[model samples]
Target chain A: MENPPVTDFATDWDHTDPAWVHDPYPIWDDLRQRCPVAHTDRYGGAWFPATHAGVSAVAQDTEHFTSRTVVLGNGRPLEDAPPAPIGVAPPITSDPPFHTIARRLILPAFAPGPVRALEPRVRELCRRLLDDLGDATEFDAATQYAQFIPPGVIVRMLGFPEADEDMFRDFIHVVLEGVNHPVEERIEEFAPIEAYITAQIEDHRAHPRDDLTSYLLGVEVGGQPLAPEHVFGTIILVLIAGIDTTWSAIGSALWHLASHPDDLARLREDPDLMPIAIEEFLRFYAPVTMARLVKRDVEFLGCPMREDDWVLLGFPAANRDPAVFPDADRFVIDRLENRHLAFGLGIHRCAGSNLARMEMRVALEEFLARYPHVELTDPEAVTWSQGQVRGPRRLPVRVASA
Target chain B: MKVTIDAARCQGHGRCFNLAPDVFGFDELGNGVVLVASPPDDRAERLARLAQVNCPEHAIDIEE
Candidate 1:
């Protein structure tokens, strides 16, 4: 196969640049048009697929694109990361048979019935949060609503002791910070998280309860019960997955809706559109930008990838791919036949997608119902967090009084 | 149509049950099982197909 033109892959991503963090879509679009399959030789040798098909192709081809413990950051692999089985890749980062077993073990706990059962509670929480916003003309949606709901639901689901919610939140921030922090600073940031999760595992083991942590502690994978580090790893994964992804989606969706009054009004006028609207929002604003390692040498979109190459799957870019999504840049809530890679594709796809969808749906529904004429206090001033997980740091909005 | 779940293969990702709870259900172990093998109508069948397709484990099979 003829090789695609080699573009310079060594562009440095300035995460500290506030402008890039606020909206990276323009840069992504430029890359997709200019260098669809480009390599960026920073934060390790990684390849970025700027187009929709390129990203999706790598994400779906698990055989060619494998996920191993090696995908874990520069730190000691989760197995040796202090918290025994908790950080180990029995499931999330594992491939195939082992991945299947670990995923099955946790599946029942997150099943729809249980998730649906939590809807009323979720809506109630959202309402209460919004209620506190009161007639305040302006408030940051991320802290007020987006940030709180996911952690609240995740803590309840994981059976984390209510007292340690703050600890968990802190751990999540620490992990996020560590993802971009220099190697020198990561050790310090990761230590507290490891210690916290380790203690939680011990507590769950001694005082078993009807929670996910307790169940994971008792359940054996690959014959022996999961190690403490595996449990911690899984918990950390779930916490990060649950909190950041959902929080980002909520933040982005809220920002989008607030900016687009017509779209918000359409949903308000006809609540039936909310379901499809949620999917459209997810597609238009993919919260997570993931990276998968090429397991073997393979050619994708006429570009060659060798083993150990990091293929960064830009979900937002895929969702916005003009070829896949007509008028991809425009947000059409009723856009039919929309199959987005926001939650990813194939086996490694997001396990908590259902819950994520439900959270977005409920939050949007409640927000629309509560404040029909809300507008961004200053759309240009709203900003987003940088790193692999993308979302607004603060989404300020003002609700017109009833 | 018959619905089968590979208990061993299933990670209990819960996508199937979440999509079509009426046709699929989980056992005490959190493993998936057919709650209704034969649906009462086309609507139920449509949902059952959705549940089967959405199963990330590919655990649900509907043989027509």
Candidate 2:
């Protein structure tokens, strides 16, 4: 079959098109094969690099791909963005030296030990939530399981009262649904969250505790105590980065497992395979569609990216790059040489990656162990979210009676 | 294996020592300081390698 013409790319990505929002992969695949570095003037003159190498190169080379501005059509500099740290690229968006210092202060809390310590608690939380599913044959797994777990963990880590978890979740939802609302409205929506985090930081300052909030509050950068704005910004960044990506992963894994019963059976039989399975799941369903700005004018893959040009790193596309992985679409839990960049690469890799992996592993292990017979009621009924981070919005499954 | 840490690069994040305490120790400034010049066993060696990977500053280097 002949590949479609490059001009067809424009028809594929309409921001308001609900169908495109649901499944942008087909469009992305077509663009990747035909025109890897395709431009879309639809959403304020954005460029979408659909190929594996094209996007990965941009993500890895932060010097070439700066993160100073909001890539998602928000024209404000990150520092001035109202969502505070989440919108601003402090540690993640900045270059080395400053980025290195900020990241160092926060890295210890997310090291393997702390993540491992949370494993038991994450498993228990998954079990309790799944147990409540009861005789109900159909429930949105995204809302029931995936959405609840990450925020719950975040609340605990931040020392926020557990009762306020739903509020936090709602705040994230507002921030992520940037496509539907104007940038000003989106900033307004995040105001309460910013205020709340600021208050928490002040509280932590008054009574120093062992939590992450207090740790950040006490951290000194360049021999000076970190600024309150930066502290608040980092906190916001952690909340957004930690919650959405992990939830999307859990949702994607559930969908994949429920859709493929044989894989689930194999996983259930060998519990030790859970670790590799988690890695495979990430490779297959990398939830984030990252973007980076070209720091210098560069030419690659026969396309020239000028300085300040936005290059979208299609991670889902990269994970399925045939050159990197043989039979990239197939899910091989025991697949060797799996160095997928789902958590990204280089200095700006996800800080909470260890915590994310631990959470997913524990959740999946406990879930499969508790409900081995669980199966999707209607695989076709699964709905995925639109925008940068994509995952199932609704996943309906039933636990088969043993 | 010998693990070397550059305190100037280290922000005293304590992640290196947290991952492999037997090999990588921390000073009062929270900067990672090597306690064992040579890893005692295979387990120590593996932990030492993990410390290198997890170090945000890339301050720790392991020599075999």
Candidate 3:
């Protein structure tokens, strides 16, 4: 099999660069061609698997690559220490055997029944959030509409206080976007969120209900109850994964439709295209970049990967790989063979994926249903999130009926 | 029509069960457990086909 030329890049790039943050596709395209498996000193030593094949290899080969330290390079996860980091979210930060158990413990919450059962409430929440906008012509789609809907679903699902949606947004922002800040500051920002998760776990232990937290507490993994830290970690993981991930996708879909009137008209004129459009949106504006820590040194696919190396599974980049996707850049709504890795491939594939896609479909369906003709008010003012999961942070649009 | 689910490939995205619950069952972990190994009825054929198509992993296979 022919492969893209691998250019040895000792100093590849950083995620925080403005050039990368504003637009990463050009950079990703460049990497996919020149350095399919590139390395950098960024984050103390990280590897970039920028192709569909490269990413799949890393994500699928958990035996060689571990999830022990996913984000921080060459260090044990915070969950490893005593007091063991409040709400130490698992599955993502764990290796096999254990990750498998954690994954099974939480699967039912996001299964088809739960997600389908939640759809009516999701639709009602979307309707109410849209209703509050009340025909405003110019509004920040991110804050005004996109941000509110997911948190409502999350808040309702997690049994958190209904009014604390903004709190969810703020905490996630710091954790996902505040990579520029020192680890200490980021931990300080995350402390309360973990505490909140811990409190919820405690509450569920005493006042167990039908909620996810209570469910986790009641389940026995490996013939033993899950640790409080694991429970806390899982809840926090669910909250972080649930709330903002799809919010950005929904916001980007709006950005797409608002900018492209023909597509909007097509979707509006024929509602049958909504499902296809949702997948297309996920493929085109694919969000999320996850990482795995190298377990041992192995020359992988012509690249020398060392032990303790951090290899980022470029999920979004893999989605746009030209070798795998024809017209990798174009937004073809009806594309049938869309085997995209917008959700990371392999065992660690997104547990929240079903939920994210469901939310995106419903959000867009109700959105264009309410306001058919929409346009970007200030396209220049549009901004996207910087680190971890990437999407529109601020998208201003003018709706005909709002 | 015959429908087979490769457990090795099925990562439990639940797309199969989501689209056609009648044709697929779920283990406690939400992994796809095909109820009807091979379709004897036309309704099961359609349902299995839909489930196969929706699977993110393409873990489900249909044979005629």
Fraction of native contacts (fnat) of each candidate: 0.07, 0.00, 0.28
Worst lDDT run of 10 residues, candidate 3 chain A, spans: A1-10
Angstrom error of the Cα, residue A133, model 3: value is 0.6
Top-DockQ candidate index: 3
Clashing pairs in 2: A64-A295, A85-A233
Best by lDDT: 3
Per-residue CA lDDT of candidate 3, range A181-284, in tens?
66566667778877777777777778988777777788886688878678777777887778778888898899999999989989988897787687778888
lDDT for every model?
Answer: 0.72, 0.72, 0.78
Q: Give lDDT tens digits, candidate 2, residues A307-377.
A: 66666667787777776678887789776446566876556677787788878887787777767876788
lDDT of 1 by residue, A159-254 (tens): 876666667667776666456565567667778877777887888888898888888888975589876556776787788778888988998888
Better of 2 and 3 by TM-score: 3
Residue B60 C-alpha lDDT in model 1: 72
Ordered from best to worst DockQ, the candidate numbers read 3, 1, 2
Give the lDDT of residue A400 in candidate 1.
70
Interface RMSD of each: 4.8, 7.2, 2.7
